[model samples]
Target chain A: MIEFSNWDILRNLLLAAQWTLLLSIAAFIGGTVVALTLTAMRLTRNVVVMRIVRVYVELFQGTPLLMQMFLCFFGLSMIGYEISAWGAAILSLTLFTSAFLVEIWRGCIDTLPKGQWEASRVLGLNFLQTLRHVILPQATKVAFAPTVGFSVQVVKGTALASVIGFVELTKAGTMLNNATFEPFKVFAFVALIYFALCYPLSLCSKYLEKKYHVAR
Target chain B: MSLVKLDQVHKYYGDFHVLKGIDLNIKVGEVVSIIGKSGSGKSTLLRCINGLEAYQQGGIAVDDKEVTSEDIQVRRLALSVGMIFQSFNLFPHLTVGENIMLAPTIVLKKSKQEAEKTARAMLEKVGLGDKFDRYPEKLSGGQQQRVAIARALAMNPKVLLCDEITSALDPELVGDVLKVLEQLAAEGMTLILVTHEMNFARDVGDRVVFMHQGKVWEEGNSKKLLSEPQTEELKQFIGAVL
Candidate 1:
C-alpha cells in the first residue's frame, strides 16, 4: 500500500475542489440563462409554448439528476455521440438547475399584485416593457433570497458528477480513500470542504431574507 | 367638444353584467363625480373609459379616438386618459419620482431630465414635492395616493379617471387627497371620479351621477342631486351613506 500523508491528501483534495467550484459556477450561469428564457416562454399567453415549457420543466424536475447524468453520458454514447464527461456533467446539471430556478422565479412573478400589470398596461407599456420596467424589478427582490439559497443546492449537486467519471471533490475523496485506506478521514475532509463552500452562501441567503422580510 | 364619450357601453364578467347600457359624455374641463353603494358598477364604468376593462358592447371614444383592444390603439388612448385607483398602485420598489417618470421616459420617449422635470412638477402640484426621492412605502396612504395622481398626470392626459381614490385612505388622510383633486379641478383638468365622500362630491363636482345595479340611475347638478333625490334608490343610497 502507498503511504499517504495527511497534507498530501488535503493538498490533492483542495486541487480537485477547484473543478467542483468551476462546475458549480458553470451550472449556475448556464442555468440562469435557460431559466430566464423558460420563464419568458411560460409567461407568454401562447398555450402551446407554455405547455412545451411545462413539459420540459416536468421532465427535468420529476426525474433524478443522477438519471439525467446517466442519460447524458451513456445514453448519448448509445446514439453514437460520445460526449466528454465534463460536457455531460454541465449539460445535465444546467438542465436540472434551470428546471428549479424557472419554477422559483415564476413563483416570484406570480406574487406581484394583479394591479401592477393593469397599472403598467394603462401607462402604455407593452408586455415585455412592463415586465422589464415594473414586474421584474419587484420580482427580483422576492426572488433574491430563495435564488441564493438554491445555489447551495447546486454546489452540493456537483458531488453527484463523480458517478459519471468527472473528478470533482467527491471523486477525489474516493480516490484518496482507495489509496490511503482511510475512508473516514478522507470523507471528513471532503465534508469540511463542502461546508466551507456552502456555509457562507447559506448565511447570505439568511441575510437577504431578513433584509427583504419587511417588504413582503 | 366632448373629451370622453361612452355610447351604450355594456360589460359582463362571464354572464354577470357589470356595466349595462351606459351612455355618458364629458366636455373639456368638466368635473363629474359618481357615487353609489358597493357593487354599483361605478368603478367598472370608470375602468372601461381607460380600456383597463373592455366593454363587450358599444363604443368608447376618448379625445375622438375609439378605444379598441388593439395594443397600439389602447396605448394611444392611454396617453390621453390617465387613471388612479383606490389602492394607490404606485410601484413600491421605485421612488416617487421614478414612479411618476416611468411612463413618460419609456412610452413617451422623453429624456431623463425632461421626465424628471415633469415628475417634480407633478409632485409639487400634489403637495408632495419633498417626497420625490422617497419610496412609496415610506409615504402615508394619502401621500402615496397623491404620488399615484402625479404618476398619472405625467402622461398629460386630457381626462383623468379616479376610482374611489380616497376610499382606501385613513379618515384624516382622505382630506389631503381630495384637496389635491380639488386643486386639479380648479386648474380645469377634466376629472371623473367614483367617490364615497358625498361632501366632496357635492362641493367639487359639477355633476354627481348616481349609479345603481350596473346602470346610471340618476344624475344632475351635484348639489341638486344630493339635496333632492328623484329616485327611491338614490334616496336610500343618500340616506345610508350620509
Candidate 2:
C-alpha cells in the first residue's frame, strides 16, 4: 500500500476543490441565462409556450438531481451521443439549477402588484420596456434573498456530479479514502471544504434579507 | 365628431358577462362622470376606452384610432389616451419626476432633458412642483394620487380616463384630487371620470352617466340627472351611495 501523508491528502483534495468551484461558477451562470430566457418566454402570455415551460419546471424539479446526472452521462452515451463527464455534469447541473431558478424568479415577478404591469402598459410602454423600467427593478429587490439562498443549493448540488466520475470535492474524498484507508479524515475535509464554499452564500442571503428588509 | 366613442362594447370574464353592449360618446373638452353600483360596468367602460381592459365584441375609438388587443395597436392608441386607477398606480421604485418622465422618455422617445421638463411641468399642474424628487412611497396617499395624475398628463393624451381616481384616498384627501380634476376640466383637457362623488359630478361634470347592469341607464346634464332620478335603478343607485 502507498503511504500517503496528511499533506498529500490535503493537496489532492484542494486540487479537486478547484474543479468544484469551477463547476459551480459555470452552472450558476448557465442557470441564470437559461432561467432568464425561460422567464421572458413565459411573459409572452402564450398558452402553448407557457405550458411547455410549466412542464419543464415540473420535470426537472420533480425528479432527483442525481437521476438527471445519470441520464445526461450514461443515458446519452448509451444512445450513441459522445458526452464527456465534465460536459454531462455541467449540463445536468445547469438544467437542475435553472428549473428551480426560473420558478423562483416567476414567484418574485408574481409578488408585484398587477397594476404595475397595467400602469406601464397603459402608458404605452411595450412589454420589454415595462420589464426593463418598472417590473424588473421592483422584482429584483424581492428576488435577492431567495436567489442567493438558492445558490447554496447549486453549490451543494455539484456534489452529485461527482457520482458521474466528475472529480470534484466529493469524488476526490472518496478516491483518497480508497488510497489511504482513512475515511474519517478525508470525508471530514470534504465536508469542511463544502462548508467553506457554501457558508458565505448562506451569510450573504441573511445579510440581504436584513439589508433590503423587503418592504413588499 | 366625438373625441371618444364606444359603440356596443361587450366584455366577459369567462362565462360571466361584465359589460353588456355599452354605447357612449363624448366630445372634445368634455368631462363625463360615470357613477354606478359596485358591479356595474362604469369602471369597465372607462377601461375599455383606453384599451386597458379588452372587450370581446364591439368597437372603441379614441381620436379615430380603433382600440384592439394587438400590442402595437394598443400602444398606438395609448398615445392618444391616458388613464389613472382607483389605487393610484404610481411606480414606487422611481422618484416622482422619474415616474412622470418614464413614458415620455422611452415610449414617446423624448430626450432626457425634454422628458424632465415635461415631468416638471406636469407635476406643477398637479400642485406638486416641489415634489419632483420625492419617491411615491414617501408621499401621502393623496400626494401619490396627484403624482399618478401628473404621470398620465405627461403623455399629453388627447383624452384622460379616471377610474375612480379618488376611491383610495382619505376622505380629506379626496377633495385635493377632485380639485385637480376640476382644474383639468376648467382647462378643457377632455376628462372622463368614474366616480362616487355625487357633489363633484354635479358641480364640475359637464355630463353624468348612470350605469346599471352594464348599460347606461340614464345620462343628462350632471345637475339635472342627479337631481331628478328618471329610472328606479338610478334612483336606487343614488339612494344607496348618497
Candidate 3:
C-alpha cells in the first residue's frame, strides 16, 4: 500500500472540491432559470401548463438524486446521444435543484395576501407587470431564507456526482482511500470539507430568516 | 349622461348570487354612499363598477365606456376609475411616494420626475405630505388608508370607488380617513363609498343607497333615507349598526 501524507490527502481533496463547487454553482444557476420558467407557468392559471410543471417537479423530487445521476450518465448513451459524466451530473443536478426551487418559490408566492394581486390588477398592471413590480418584490423577501437554506442541500448533493465518475470531492476521497487503505481518515476529511463549504451558507440562511421574518 | 351607470348587473360566485339585477346611476362629482349589513352585496356592486369583479349579466359603464373583461379595456377603465379597499392594499415593499407613483409611471407612461411630482402633490392633498418616504407597514392604519387614497388619486381618475375604506381604522384614526373622504367630496371628485359610518354618510353623501339581499332596498337623500327607512331591512340595518 502507498503511504499517503496528511498534506497530500488534504491537497487532493481541496482540488476535487473545486469541481464540486463548480458543479454546485452551475446547477444552482441553471436550476434557477428553469425554476423561474416553471413557476411562471404554474402561475399562469392554465390547467395544462400547471399539470405539466407539477409532473416535472414530482418526477425529480420523487426519485433519489442517485438514480437521476445514473439515468443521466448511462441512460442517455443508450438512446444515441453520448454525454460526458460532467454533462450528465450537471443536467441531473440542475433538474433536481429546479424541482425543489420551483416548489419553494411557489410557496413564497402563495404566502402573499390575495389583496396584493387584486390591488395591482386594479391599478392597471397586467399579469407580468404585477408580478415584476408588485408581487415578486414582496415574494422575494419571503423567499430569500428558504432559497439560501436550499443551497446547502445543493452543495451536499454534489457528492452524488462521484458515482458517475465526475471526480468531485467524494470520488477523490474514495480513490485516495483505495490507494492508501485509510477509509476512516479519508472520509473524515471529506466530511470536514463538506461541512466547511456548507456551514457558512447555513448561517447565512438563518440570518436572513431572522432578518426578513419580521416582514412576513 | 351619468358619469357612472350600472344596468341590471348580476354577479355570482358558483351558485351563490352576490349582485342580482342592480340598476344605479351617479352623476359627475356626486358622492354616493352605499350602506348595508355584512353579505348585503354593497361592496360587490361597488367592485362591479370598476370591473374588479365580473358581473355575469347586464352591464356597467364608466365615462361612456363599457366595463368588460377584455384586458386592454379593463386597463383603460382603470385610468378613469380608481378603487380603494378597507385593507388599504398599499404595496408594502414600496415607499409611500413610490406606491403613489407606480400606476402613473407604468400605466400612464409618465416620466419619473412627473410622477413623483404628482405623487407628492396627492400626498399633500391627503395630509400625508411628510410620509412620502415611509413604508406602508410603518404608518398608522389611517395614514396608510390616506396613502391608498393618494395612490389612487395620482392616476387622475374621473371617479373613485371606496369599499369600506375606513372599516379597518382604529376609532380615533377613523376620523382622519373620513376627513380625507369628506375633503374629496368637497372638491367634487366623483366618489362612491360602501361604509358603516352613518353620520358621515348623512353629512358627506349626496345620495345614500341601502343594499339588502343583493338588491337596492332603498335609496334617496342621505338624511331622508337614514331618518326614515322605507323597508324593514333598512330599518333593522340602521338599528343594528347605529
The residue pairs found clashing in candidate 2 are none
Can you write out model 3's per-residue Cα lDDT over A47-108, one digit (the tens) per residue? 99999999999999999999999999999999998999999999999999999999999999
* Stretches of model 1 off by over 4 angstroms after superposition: A214-216
* Candidate 3 chain B least-lDDT 10 residues: B68-77
Q: Write the per-residue lDDT of candidate 1 for residues B58-150, one digit (tens) a residue.
A: 999998889876767778888898989888888888889999999999999999999999999999999998998898998999999999999
TM-score of 1: 0.95
Q: Rank the candidates by DockQ, best first.
A: 2, 3, 1
Higher-ranked by DockQ: 1 or 2: 2
What would the per-residue lDDT of candidate 2 be over residues A1-216, giving only the tens digit for each residue? 789998999899999999999999999999999999999989989999999999999999999999999999999999999899999999999999999999999999998899998899889999989999999998899889999999999999999988889999999999999988999999998998999999999999998988877554
Q: Write the per-residue lDDT of candidate 2 for residues B1-242, one digit (tens) a residue.
A: 79998899999989889999888889999999999988898887887787777899989888887888778887997788899998888898899999999999999899999999999998999999999998888899999999999999999989998988888888999999999999999998999999999999999999999988888888999999999989998888889888
As a whole number from 0 to 100, the lDDT of residue A170 in candidate 1 is: 99
Give the whole-model CA lDDT for all candidates, comma-separated. Answer: 0.93, 0.91, 0.92
Sorting all predicted structures by lDDT, with the top scorer first, yields: 1, 3, 2
Please give the distance, in angstroms, between residue A11's alpha carbon in candidate 2 and its true position after superposition.
3.7
Where does candidate 1 chain A have its weakest 10-residue lDDT segment? Answer: A207-216
